[model samples]
Target: METKNINIPAHGSNVLRADIPAEYKWHVQDIYADEAAWQAACAEFKALLPQLEALKGSITSAQGLYNALHLQDKMSQMLDKLYAYPRLQQDADNTDQHLQAIAGEAEALAAAFSSANSFIEPEMLGLGKEKVAAMLAELPELAEYKFYVENLLRITDHILSADKEAIFAQSRLATGTAASAFRSLVSADMEFPPITDGEGKPAIVSEGNYMLNMTSPDRELRKNSFRGLMGTYHKYRNTLATTLTGSARTAYFYASVHNYKDTLESCLAEDNIPTSLYDGLIQTVHDNFAPLHEYIQLKKDVLGYDEFHPYDLYMPLSKAADSFACTFPEACAKVEEALAPLGEDYIATLHKGLTEGWIDIYENKGKRSGAYSWGVYGVHPFVLLNYQQRYSSISTLAHEMGHALHSYYSSMNQTYVNSEYTIFCAEVASTTNENLLLEYTLQRANDEQKIYLLNQFLEAVRTTVYRQVQFAEFEKFIHGEITAGRSLQAEKLENYWLESNRQYYGPALTVDQELASEWSRIPHFYTPFYVYKYATGYSAATAFSSAILSGAPDAVEKYLGFLKAGGSDYSLNILKNAGVDLNTPQPVTVTLQKFA
Candidate 1:
């Protein structure tokens, strides 16, 4: 996707100046040229049922099974287009009726495909992986799909009863609806308190306005907004809890019905991510508590606060009056130039992304808040950012673009069946780009940019590594308690959160009384222990970034290979493919040493 020809105007101080750039409006035509064509494809997918059924019995032998799997891969790959069109379309201008309908059509298509998929897993398990692999080895078509087949086979031990699995699959209408509704609620309905300026003057606050306020150079106003927003959100904690609990219950229910021991086991079982990776993050954080505490001390000292509080964390430690503020186009150029070490091919894709219409790069009316990179498979990634004119906001451009470029490269290279990389490897790509951008900017810096880049790196280390590890540890504890059949009461959750704050911060900083409610606000806890990678990814990315910058022999080649790998390898193997060993303690220790 490219935004080259789109007419987007960056107008106003706090308002969206540009309409949705044309090319940035995903190439839905890549899936089907028009609504009528989408309907035609829908009919085609449904018409294949007789064929999908015929392959069921025929897949009993190796050749028959290999042929069937190849065909199934085609059907599934095409269905992605049929499903992805709506979600991406709706996400662009979430309120558009046509886009919403498009999303609905895609989801309905997915449901139909799931009905077909409900049989594939069980039938494959029924055939037994060993027999299927032996037969697949002899067939050329199936050989390329071994990783996918092996991925499926590895989870056969946890396969639910065929009847139970089918019921769960069909129940997507109700079960998925619950989560979807809450997502809409949070995205489209939730509101916050009015923001105040540095002198405690009142200002209007809305979903899209809070980001500009949070990055305000006025420490006091940022604090006021942070406190006020947290206070307002705390009021809806119970409601948000319902949203999260409903999602968790669905996870728990499926895990239980699917014959898995618990939610964590079931989640990691399919993804092939080990529970130890999660545990490794927590243990590493616990062992390195002192650096985090020292980093907190560094903030308190630099900010000249009598005692540091959590609200003070996001504020910058140093700022210069004569700073260069980047407009959207300039930021894009900086990012593209900074990441040039990734090779010409990578830079060219980013160039197309900027020029062609892959980015919706401004704040606008009724736009969904926050930044993200998303699109259906086969199309280039689109980025949504409310690009305010601030230095840190420029880093955000680099960050979201990292995700977009990662998606772009992976989709271009891999088939839809295996194109999308897991969240486990996701943060590294984005964070690695941030690292590169910082290195390049800092290397070319005057005193001000150097200070800004150093402080930015500090913030990155603190937020991604320390803060997320803290969340990861908290999530693990919460899940362990829940899995052990204990209730996750709000009071218990707060106490553990505050106690955690004490341990991680040491005896230095005073914990805010109200901030004890932080646990109630973190939605990651509800995702069943998912935030650890934010820390581990940063640590790993730091090592990788250092290598590429150090100009070590073959360093750039290895790092680029990692980026191009897509979902061709598992998370650990992907890192090893790029030349880092997660199993050894090296990456963790290296990150800690950098902090020291």
Candidate 2:
């Protein structure tokens, strides 16, 4: 595949999927060839569920265990491919009813697969560790699953009875109701009134364009966009509150049933992360507030605002880099040049992904708003990007490709069972790329551009580290409230969010009332305790990128090893061996000091 010359459509064009060239769109066919093939695979997968059920109670023997495990891997790989096709299509253009129906069907199939396969773990746990170890030793081929078995046995205390496990697995179908409702409400139901654009024309306020509006130089537009966005959520406050409360309660229910102390423990336990690390992240950020405050104060000074408001936060301080923009091809070239420090092989693979139909490179009518990188186990990774002709879009390209390359390396090296990495380490690869891109751009910048790029780096750390930790702190509070038998009422949640913002941003900034409703709009809150990883990942990336750029011995080699390790080992241990340790506060503190 060769790189194609494609330009992003002008803003507000309402470009259709057919308007974009084929190369600019990802090849979902690469997963299944067509919908007919996907349907056939789904049927084949359904037929194999009974076969998996047949091995449920037969894992006592070495051969029985191997057969069950191997079959499970095979089925899982099939399901991954099966699910990826429709989800990718739906994300590309969600307006199509057929795509929506298939996506829903794929989700249902996944839930069914989960319920059917729930018995494997409990049954394996029933055999006892020593017996399972004996079976593993008896079968040389089982060596591949030794780590998995050991990890399972390590959490044996949490594994419930077979019946209870089945109930829990079936609960998967209902567990996502809160999150699903939240997505529907925000994406489809909620409507923000149009705000004036920087040019004094009416611009629609959407989740996609909200950030773009925030970055606009027009002060009224920024304030109105902020007000319009958050005020709409405020109008639906009660409904949004109920949805979030349901999500929290759901998490608490699972935590309590699993014998964990709290939702935080239950969430971190999967990756073997300690609750102390999560707590320490908040405390460490609290301890190091001067740099953040100083930055905020500088922003206020630069913007010449008597009262600094939430809407003013994203405004570019440097006029020079504020107008920076790049087309999709230019963004790709910039990212490739920025990532060249990872060596020729890494860049070559990245170029292949950029050129080949591995990316849906531009936003279209009804496409997903944000960006992500996801892939089937055996096939190459795919990236969904709403590419704009701006520096932020370039950085986003680098960030997501970092995820893509991480997935690519892991899938190439690990089995399907371990190809998926934990959320704890997911941000490391992506942020490292962002950090490298910033560094590359800064190095090549003139004096005026340097000021802008430096501010960009500062804002990245502030957002990725400080802002995320603030969100983490809020998560801990809300979950603790639920754990303590309290409710997450709308007003109560809003009040807490206000106070938290004040404490984090300090007196340098005025806490707007609209900002209090900000918590209601964050979709990540549906996934309890997940946001802190962005902060931790940024810290770890800072460490890795510093070392790699400073010519540390084998730094690139070590970082690549971390990517390839995937979920094959514990997340913390993987990072430890790769040189950053989240077990201590050094990484966070060191990252903050750089900001200072």
Best by TM-score: 2
Off by over 4 Å in 2: 1-7, 10-21
- Angstrom error of the Cα, residue 575, model 1: value is 1.3
TM-score of each: 0.90, 0.97
lDDT of all the models against the reference? 0.71, 0.87
Q: Assess candidate 2 and give its TM-score to the true structure.
A: 0.97
Ten residues in sequence with the least summed lDDT for candidate 1: 10-19
Over 320-411, each residue of candidate 2 has an lDDT whose tens digit, in order, gives 65556866777788899999999999999999999888998777766777899996688899999887667788899999999999999999
Q: lDDT per residue, candidate 1, 1-596, as tens digits?
A: 23255344643223432354553343556556887887787888888856876665566776777666766777887787777666655654555667677677767666666666566667767877678778678777676677778887777777765556667777776676645665566455666666767776887555555656655667677677667766766676666555555666777778887678878778776657777776776787688888878878877887788987766766666574227475567777888988898779889988887776666666555466667777456656767776766776777878877888778777777766567787777888788888999889888888866876787787787778778888877766766666676655666766887898889887667788667666655545556656777777787788788888888889888877776677877878888878787766568767876776
Candidate whose lDDT is highest = 2
Model 1's TM-score against the true structure: 0.90
Residue 196 in model 1: shift from native, Å? Answer: 2.3
